[model samples]
Target: MQEITTIGLDIAKSVFQVHGIDAFGAVIVRRQLRRSQVLPFFRKLSGCVIGIEACATAHHWARELEKVGHEVRLMPPRYVKPYVKRNKNDAADAEAICEAVQRPTMRFVPIKSPEQQSVLMLHRTRQLFIRQRTALINAIRAHLAEFGIVAGIGRHGVEKLLDLITRGEDERIPPAAHACLMALAAQLAMVKRQILEADRRLLAWRRTSKTSKRLEAIPGVGPLIATALVASIPDPNVFRSGRDLSAWIGLVPKQSSTGGKERLGSITKAGNRYLRSLLVVGALSVIRRAKQLGYTRHPWLVRLMERRSVKIAAIALANKIARIAWAMMAHNESYRTPLPASA
Candidate 1:
């Protein structure tokens, strides 16, 4: 039997399918292994290249396989989809992954460290609580509106509603409705506390990371965005240029060019939605500050605001910010302000 040189592992909750090929591209093994049998099976085989789809638990398996002296490469599932000959099944998917891993042009996902994963989890949890808080606030407002009791917009308005709920003296609210509102208010307060705790933990983690601290120097990138970018991008050098990073973050315009004509539409929005949203929100903050101050150091942004809508300008600024962030991370340098053009 020839020695296997490459393998594709399709992982699941309790079962995993493995397809392996020898140096000459001949199938050497194709079988399903129970969850408990996976490690022992790999231990008996010689070290080889392994391909895994970047999905839930993929990183954990990749790290484990690497610890066993195998070279693990994680590819986005979408990129491997094209290699599937037909009939999507665990066996077929494993075969496709095996083929895709050997392609020189195929892009692979960088394995994230446990710490990075933890920080991301923090971000996700905080976001979840924030959404829940918003829902609670909206529900409370809607319920109160039915009784002809309305508060103004923003925190002051929300406070007014909360005061009414706690006082339990508003004749407008029926006892039943007041009880429900009290329950929602309690949940909202609890979620708010959770969000604040998440923020505190995130900030604590950020202070320990020099990269996150350095990223904070970039305009429009606060501790939240800085920490997110640092945790999300494990290796900035994987990107050939700042533009590549921007494109990966889905800040680039979508292209539909054909023949000799060029057509472009909105941003592809293909990559990390969280990062994209953070950058855009940060950009909007910068724009708002610039408008209020009646000036900005970047003349380009000034010109952009003069012609383009604020939202469009915000997107463009976000793209530029993403590129700047990539350059800083890739080069291990601080953000440098570009000098104004000589008239």
Candidate 2:
């Protein structure tokens, strides 16, 4: 029933802390609420600005709070970290979030929509399953190698191994080991099927999503790049330019500055790991095909390949592709490839 000027919320799985202050910067309210009671408490409060760290589940909370007529700002966790006092606790974090949100220089995270999260989740689940399947395949291959059977070390190799195991070609194999191998092979097949299904869902979602469709129009951006870009970036404005987007995705080089001197290193390797990886893979494929299909005769590819190894060229190209993808998203235009100069 009180007029709260600003509120800092420290959200957790079960309990939450609400730190409230008034116009003159006086602490007016400090209360702890259970998960079930948190929303009702906010609904009853006078509409005010709510500050929360841009953490897990923050967007969902941000949208929920907005519906109650309160403005929500989600601060990046790194920015909020410097504000925490010596004694770090819920209340301290809540208070720190309170101070961080009011700064004009602070960059707040753009709240992701539920649909965005859903599409991203498919990618994440597929990544997890792929990792598991890879580990299992390696183990199966290693175990079989002890008995003079070897998997040649590729997806196709794993597939063939599974076929050999399923057909029971090795009757001399121990029953227990055969059982384990068969089980692993079956699970690996399941995971492959799931990954394919996820790809199907992503492709379907891309068909209906304008942003993904536009991104996919770019030369190298297939389902992976299209989905990764849309899912990872919640706001295009957060990046001042496409270069900034690429840099944020760790495509840009790291730098160190001293007195009148500057040195640059390899890519910073910060930000969304999955998106960076997808971009790298897409770019590598493009580079490989360009070499094999004689597209290397193209000026850019020729000059790039001449300057560095194919692997390095692929990474640089990937970096440029990421920037271009951002530009496409920000400008709401289809990709415009560069044309050769007039004769």
Candidate 3:
């Protein structure tokens, strides 16, 4: 081996591909490694730069590679795509990853710690359960509507339907249909319990994390949003500014500039979808509260709401909130309430 200086690894469930080059850009190694052989193979090589595409199991592999004295850089798969010469294959993808890591301008994803990954996993699982709950609720509603038994929308309405199913007193419901609705009702109850448990775990995590606790002080930020934000962003300083963080969360407008003419459309919605949606939902809550009070602490939001529709204002508020969060995290400071317009 001619002193392999850089390596690109394409990882999968069972097999992995490796491509390596010397300092002089000459091929040093091109091979495949089984799942069992990956760590042992890297252990034999001297410390060198290794590139891997950010994907499933990428973080685990990166953590493993780093433990064996190798420098690992994780590149977004999209950024590596341009470097691929021809047909897509594990080998080509590995080569592209190898090439992309050496680029001075290429952006790399920050390696998340196991703790962060765990928190994100909790969030994902909770989201899954919530979706299941919604599906169950909708199914029950549709089934009941078939029997001319309909309830209003919301938790109370869902509970009413559940009550009907539990009592088995709705004469309109067919016996067979009643049995099916009972099954769904049981699932809905289980899912609700699971959601509450998830919320409890998240709350416990938020209590232990000083960052999450501090983040909760910000308007519209609850324990769930605070914990998710902290876990999703491993290092706030990776972003150059609050705007960058907001943009990364896909809260900023999409641009289609040409010939020095600036044209912007809807938000790019390119980055972490979960975080973006959370921020937007939080913003909407703030807007709703402000409307109820007929005044807001932040005059800028009040002015913006006066000029734009509620939805647009919510987006702008979400963008601002993201920026505020970035600043707080990067600087290790609490959120400062903006002065009232009168002041």
Candidate 4:
């Protein structure tokens, strides 16, 4: 009977390391292959179990290797990090990945499909352009403030500042500074245009996506948020329950317990920062809007608001929303707002 050996892949930009052992855990193959050579090498080899650290290009390679009849598993970076010996190198890292994959407690990241990746690309690019636009606005404001000009933070503020600069409406602003401001304003406008274009395209894509549509059915979750969530959460079943979804999004408190004493602190903040941030923002909007209109007797929200600050209430709402999202996605159903517990 042929041994069901395992192989570890340490991925890099140009070079890669492959570590494998025989039935007795003896190093049978320690090979180096270039990026172009990696796929072809695997194509020629017999089907076996392969492990790789979850990072850039891991998903693509995992999908490709799986297509070739190999069982590919991707372990999170932290899981593989523990197995790395004193001196970390490609070969040792590859070996560690292999060892980690065999652990009973090991957790794996689901390989994202190309469509999921495409949606994520849109979100990443939009974030980058927004950041650049903000920087440009700040730079313009700082440069002009040398002559006593102040610009607020926002895309709208960019337009207003540009109008002020080009129109020479400000007595404190000089002509030379206005010239520099105009160029900076142009850059800001360009970035805004790029962001808008990307957002439009992303929304269009989200509109047709079944997952995004289901997510969007929930309140406070628009197309952008829905699409981003679907992309980030490729496999919802990995989470045991809806609460785990909130915890995964950093919406749950951190726990520190010792000697039969337990204390819950601030959020773990361990998962995707972008998704957490979006949820928090959405929660805040819901609360603010609710106040101006009318508040429902949601027991959790009532207790949270009375005992804690509005910020805490907002976070609780976000946590609930995260759980709701998980339930909807995991169960493959639309949002179901269960009745609030007794107040």
Candidate 5:
């Protein structure tokens, strides 16, 4: 009807809402489609601009829509919120998405390919198993503490506790209590094994990814961080500059400025928590090495560490690393550390 020029779609597990407007921005269609009807519905319409929130299933649908000759744009859910007129509903959200996609300055998310999503799946699964392993270890520790069978910190310590429990050396641990701990210990071992398998798979993936291999050349970057960045950010050129990329990664400071006064606080910590944490962890490794070498190799980091706390310096370094990574990806170059000029 009225040759719909643009459409906004609100996607859910079983149903989807659609809002459409003509070239003149007049409302033309409002409808809902069941999951099974989605492709058939879109197949009936001519190619048009479509907007969707960048949520769980958005990328898959975007790819499908694109293949059908429709232009799809995905915006972050928060960016679409401001366009909502009143109470939130599926229809309202669709309308907001429709409006948001037309804004010239509205940011959009890159649609990742199935291959990119697969690599990310590996990382996510690995993270889940690691978390489960940690929880099991903590549970074991807590249970042992009740019987005064405490061990020192870290995973090795947990293994020691498990050894004692398995040997039945302590009368303090009743047979019944020990059995429960043994079950937990078994789970911990299984989770650890799963995590290791994930790691092996990631490493195999990294070996085949030229971009991941290039990213690994940077200081403090290893297979894990390299593969993660390559998977999560399909296109680094979407950002205008390295600083923009760092900001997108939420490595930049939060600003609260008014009346032409500049006020900056801690980092916003707004985007991609997993990537941000990986960058920070990489930065920490660099910092640790720099400290051991008496900061001889990294002059800038030496100056930064002298003026700021280790935590702040680590964040700053992470921001710098993210920027460097963006440049590498944008320019298709491997990382190369700069050398100080001759006196």
Candidate 6:
């Protein structure tokens, strides 16, 4: 039997498919296993390099495999796509993973620890509740609008609308309609409470994490952004430089340069949308303050504002903030704004 040197695992909820190859790249093991049998099968094999797509259960399996002395490498699913020979099925994906994992230039995702994943879960849960709250608010507003009842815009306005729904004083709203709106209103209240609790938990995390605290010292970063970045980015050193980190966040401009002429356009917007949005919001906050104060305090920002529109300047500042944040994490240093040189 050819010694199985590499195994590509395509993981699913109930079953898993595996394609194993020998040192000379010959197919040695092509098999499927139930979820319950996966660990036992791998335990029988000698320690070998395992490759899996970086999705759903990949991190958990990576940790499990590494415990038994196997070298596990996870590749982004997109990077493995080109390796598929014919069809896109479990076997083909497993084969692609096997091939991609061995490529010298293939990038691997950092295996996140349980703690890091837990923190990310908190962020995700909070975001979910917040979104639910927004949808509920919009529903309530739309329903009220049908009866010529309209509240002002914003959370305070939502409160006014809720009060009207709760009081049941408006004769225009039929009893059946009132009951339905009240139910939605009740749900909205519950979601709001959940969101507030989530915020408290995130704040607690922000207070305890030293790196998160350091991130908060940056101009645009608040507790939310600070804690979020700490949770999302498991290893800053994965990137070779701060610019790479910024690019990874998709804060850099999209470029189409050919034949020595450079063409640049809007941001790539390729990476974590949540993180990018938070950073852009933070940048907008900074820009608002800078605009009000005439940018005297941030001379560099002033010069940037002169060259570009306020929105573009804000994005550029956000890119800088991302780079600065990467530097802070990479160096284990706190953020300290560089002072303008004296004339």
When superposed on Cα atoms, how far off is each prediction in RMSD? 0.9, 2.0, 1.2, 2.3, 1.1, 1.5
Worst 10 residues of 6 by lDDT: 289-298
| Residue 26 in candidate 2, Cα distance off native in Å | 2.3
Per-residue lDDT value at 280 in model 2: 88
lDDT of 6 by residue, 1-343 (tens): 9789999999999879999999999999998999999989889888999999989989999999998889999887878999999968999989989999999998788898898888788889989998898899999999999999998998789999999999999999999999999899999989889989988988987878999999989999999899888888889998899888787789999999999999999999876788898999999999998778777778888888878998898889899999999999999998787887799
Cα lDDT of model 5 by residue, 1-343, tens digit: 5899899999999999999999999999999999999998898999999999999899999999999889999998989999999989999999999999999999999999998999999999999998898888889899999988889997679879989977987999999998998899888889888999999999999989999999988988899999999988888988999998888889999999999999999999888999999999999999999878777678889888888999999999999888888899999998888896566
What TM-score does candidate 4 get on C-alpha atoms? 0.92
- Compared with the true structure, what per-residue lDDT tens digits does model 3 show for residues 167-210? 99878998999889889988888999999999989888888899
The estimated TM-scores of all candidates read 0.98, 0.93, 0.97, 0.92, 0.98, 0.96
**In model 1, which regions exceed 4 Å deviation?**
none
Which portions of model 5 show Cα errors greater than 4 Å?
Answer: 341-343
lDDT for model 5 comes to 0.92
lDDT (10s digit) by residue, model 4, range 1-343: 3454889999999999999876678787888999999889888778888999889899999999999889999887987899998788898898898899888888778889998999899999999998997788778877877877666767676667788877878878767777777888778888989999998999799878888898877767888789988999899998899887787778899999999998999888877889999988888888787777767735466567878999888888888888888888898898766686655
Q: Which pairs of residues collide in candidate 5?
A: none
Lowest summed lDDT window (length 10), candidate 2? 294-303
Give the range of the ten consecutive residues with the poorest summed lDDT in model 1. 290-299
**Which stretches of model 6 miss by more than 4 angstroms?**
none
Candidate 1 vs candidate 6: the lDDT winner is 1
Runs in model 2 deviating more than 4 A are: 295-298, 341-343
Q: Itemize residue pairs with steric clashes in candidate 3.
A: none
- Record all residue pairs in model 4 with backbone atoms less than 3 Å apart, i.e. clashing: none
lDDT of 3 at 86: 99
